[model samples]
Target chain A: MLNNSITAAMADIATAVKRYSLVGMLGWQDVRQRYRRSAVGPFWLTISMGVMIGTIGLVFGQIFNSPMKEFLPFLAAGMILWSFISTCVLEGCSSLIAAESIIKQLPIPLFVHILRTIWRNTLILAHNIVIFPLVLLAVQKPLGLEALWSIPGFALLVLNLAWISLILSLLCARYRDLPQIIASVLQIAFYLTPIMWLPSLLPGRAGTYLLDLNPIYHLLQIVRAPLLGQDVSTVSWCVAGGMALFGWCIAIIIYGLYKRRIAYWL
Target chain B: MACIEFNNACVDFPIYNASARSLKKRLIQVATGGKISSNEQGRVIVRALEDLTFSLNDGDRVGLLGHNGAGKSTLLRLLSGVYAPSAGTASISGEVASLIDISLGIDPEASGRENIFMRGILLGMTKSDIAEKLEEIIEFSELGDFIDMPVRTYSSGMHLRLAFAVSTTIRPEILIMDEWLSVGDEGFKHKAEARMNELVEATSILVIASHSRDLVLHTCNRVIWLEHGKIKMDSDPETVTRAYFGH
Candidate 1:
């Protein structure tokens, strides 16, 4: 029975992945629908992100007593990646819930909804990340071969988010208050993950271990470190990779057990 | 060769109330070993469908007749592969289009043309297929220039016309519908009915749930009467409809 359930869940995931055209179009529609009537459209998101980064960078730099020249790019990269991760986690909770109408009316795989959510957020992230290069230029950060590491780092990040979305979407569908709980958790995670402050500010060995223990910090390091022209630490890569594998294992198990229950939950 | 088979299939819905859905309450219940548990905090299971054993082969038009709380819609969902059976099994073979809600994926902010694509994708049509049927769908909807405008601006009748057009445009092996789909004025209803007949005739299998006896007699050859989540009668539409209505 367990093997059969796992096989069925795998088949569902395969079918959802095979229907990429449908998933991609739906994701594009999701992004388009949100900014339909606005004059500035989704660029409004880009503009707002830019303004937020600027304000936060100056204020936090002064507060941390760090140089704006070094700090702005670091803050910008971390903030941009954090936005992507946070939105993926937050909206991931509603990936299936938001698509309840479509789910009920159609016979598509549940993972299709998760893919659509991730893709939609990825599109929005694309819009927000346009500010990154300009910030790098503003901060006089040079482009280097090390910066290319961010490409693989981002690919891994997307893979991790996909599994995370799958698990959260199902769990949140089952438990209605989960989305709110996730939101509050992310609020705490924002401070705990070291997005605003340098890890160096922490006094000693315990601070280093504490940062190491944070999966989000490791996830952030893999992408942000490279984008800010720093070495991509092997420990960060190993932790992020391990998290991806561990997350997928949990996601697949939960999905296998609860795959059929989602429609009922909805 | 579309077919659907259910072997003693059952569906139980765990209706989670607020307290049951909350992690804190559930944890407390688990930790306290039901000592502090209230009935409301426990999971309430509703057996929506029970021991539903049936098979539908090609060229069959089956109508489901049941009271409000009976499992007509649940059966349709089961056939459409929306809800897997909690016990037993169901095997469905087909490209299925479940018209439970024709306007399900319609976006109010999008134009009728864009909604056609959106709704078409949701209906299991590929982008290229929708592109090919674009002219046919728009022509069938009879919205003319309104097709270019946001669906939010459409009158209720116009919106129904667009939804009906996009939904029926698909050619599925098995078509599952709930209730009778009605649209617009008398003229439009006749047109929609004619189009629906054409679509249904082309499909290999049709499962419809409805309270309308005349509709069942007109559209279906076989009928299943459900009472309290069990099949009470399965026979010719004439016999079941007559018995169902006590006429």
Candidate 2:
């Protein structure tokens, strides 16, 4: 029975992944639903983000004494990736709960809801992503072929986010208070994850290692470093990859044990 | 080939309030081996369905009759594969279309046509399948000019009509329904019931949970009467309805 449940859990994920088109359609609908009334529609995702980056870049560039050309592009990329990761984690908490009616009435795999959340945020990330290149063009920065590495880096980043979101969705559904705690934790993590500041500004070698220990820091570097035409540390890639593997394994086990109980819990 | 099987299947609802759902309290209990939250075992379990073991085959139209909280809806959910049993096993081997809440994923802000696509996919229809039937669904709903308009703009009757059309458009090997189709005015209700009968006839197995004694007696070959999460009587419709409705 134990082994059977595990197999079912794995099968459920496999089934949902194969129906990626369904997830894509639902995800697009979610994006459309949120900005339905606005004239710019979903493009507000890019405009609002541009305004925030412009304001923060101006103030923070002056405070850190970093050049606007360099700092703005850096902050833009970091904020884009960080927001994607954060919302994937935050909204994933309600992925199942928000679809309570569908989950109750339909027999679709539970994993499909998590994938929908991730796919929805991925669409938002695509919108916010426009800012990075525009900022780079504004500053007239040339990118090397090393930037192509960001492809694999971003893939790894999304894979890692998926597992973490899966865990949070399951736990949060059972524990009503978890979303509050998760929101607080993410709020704190934003300030600590080096999105607005440079790692070099930290005190010393101790600072780099501390950042190394933060998985979010490693996840950011793997994608950001490559996009910035810099070399991402092997340590960052390894950490991000390892987190994806182990996190998925743990997520599968937890899902296997509790997925059947999900309906009852709700 | 479609079959429904349940062996000692039981569904227990874990009733946990805000306090019991705290991870901090759960962690404390784990560490100290002592209760940190209220209630027995820090949770109350409501056994929604108990020891339900039965087998349904092709051509067996089963109707569930029960009072409120008597587990009719829970049994329908179990049959449709929404809620897996907490203990024992329940397996459904067929494509299941549970019309419990056909408007489950309909977005009010979306146009009537888009909501059709949304509800269609939610009922497990592929995009191409929905595309092929799109005209039929729209025509049946009779919201011609309003089809492109946002569902939020539609009146309450119009909204329900759209949902009913899109929901019934789905045809599955195993069909599950909460009640007889009764939507819109007398005119639309006639169309809805005709389409529902067509769907019921096409399915290999039918499971309808309803309070209407006459409808069950007319539509179902077999009836299962549940009382407080257990079967009170399960036999032919004529016999079960006679006992259940005191006819």
Candidate 3:
């Protein structure tokens, strides 16, 4: 009986999903909803990143004796990757809670909420991509066919984010304070990560370990490394791949155990 | 083609103390050798539906009558595949359209035209399907100039008119409705009711829950009276309604 019901539910979800080009529209809606009624729309994200990069590059480059041209592109890449990582973790915290209305009322697939979160953040990430071109052109940075690798790099980032969003959603639904803790932890991670500071600049063993322990740093490495036309390390792929597997495995377990109770939880 | 069967369905929910949003509080209580009394925990296990079993064939106009929390909504949720039963199985065939919490998927900040896509997506309609029905939904809603306005700016009537129009546009094999609440003004009510009546005619199977005896008598040929998460009486509408009213 349970098997039959599970199969039926799966079929229903498939049908619901097939009816709409959910990926296409959901991504658009997520972007539009966030920037609604705003003058610049998503360009605001690009503009702000641009301003931060310019200020930090000019002021800090002079202080650190690093060339402003080299520092500007680095800063732009850092800011964009930081935004992507922060958005994935922060939004993962409320992926379920934010959709409480739909969750409580409709019988749609729970995964749709996670998809919505990833798609929403992906939109911002796309906008942030605009800065790379501007920075590259301004700095006269090396750009070639290797830069196109960012497309696949970002695809991996999004896939990994999907796993993270799903697992975090299940956890936050069970634990209310998780979202706040996650948000606070992400704030700390931003500093721990080599966002404003270069990794080589970190003094010693302790700092290197801290950088190594932080997953967001690796995520940024995969993205920024490819965008900078550098070869991505195997370490980045291994860490991201491991986290994705671990997250998705745990999510499936939790989903299987509590799939029946999720509705009542809402 | 629309057939629905529920067999000894049960839904069991855990009773977690969500009031204090911290594990430390719960852990402290646990370490202190059960600070929270067992009686307090009984308030947590909610059996929304228990051992429910039923089947409906095509063209079954079944009205479900129950007081709030009597498993009426749970039954509808189960039938609609929203909430799976904790035990037993529900075998359903054909397309199901549930009208539970009408206007649920509409975004308040989006225009009526945008909401058409939002609500339609939630209701399992493709983008092309929403586009196809856009004109008919707009016409039936009669919100002429206001269709382009944000839903937040719409009156309660306008909200219902558009929601009902969009929801009823697709004729599902099974149409399930929770108690239809009032959405708009008097004239709007007439138009909405007419649309609902047409929807009823178009659907092959209809399930509704309401407290109103008149509504049950008028719209349903069969009725099930539920009490305390159990079926109190199940029979023809006139018979059950009469028994319920004690007339």
What are the TM values for chain B, all candidates? 0.95, 0.95, 0.86
Stretches of model 2 off by over 4 angstroms after superposition: B35-40
What is the CA-based DockQ of model 3? 0.53
Model 3 alpha-carbon drift over 4 Å, by segment: A1-20, A23-27, A203-208, A211-213, B13-15, B19-21, B26-43, B180-194
For model 1, the superposed segments whose C-alpha errors exceed 4 Å read B36-41
Candidate 2: tens digits of C-alpha lDDT, residues B42-145: 66888999999999999999999999999999888988898888898898999988888766888998899888888887777888999999999999999999
Candidate 3's iRMSD: 2.1
TM-scores for candidates 1 onward, in order:
0.96, 0.96, 0.89
Q: Judged by DockQ relative to the true structure, which candidate is superior, 1 or 2?
A: 2
C-alpha RMSD between model 3 and the true structure: 3.2
**lDDT-better candidate, 2 vs 3:** 2
Instruction: Give a tens-digit lDDT track for model 3, residues B104-129.
Output: 76777889998888778778788888
For candidate 1, what is the DockQ-based docking class? medium
Candidate 3: Cα lDDT at B17: 70
Model 3: how far residue B232 lies from native, Å: 1.1
Best by lDDT: 1
Question: lDDT of each model, Cα atoms only?
Answer: 0.89, 0.89, 0.78
Ten-residue segment with the worst summed lDDT in candidate 3 chain B?
B35-44
Clashing pairs in model 1?
none
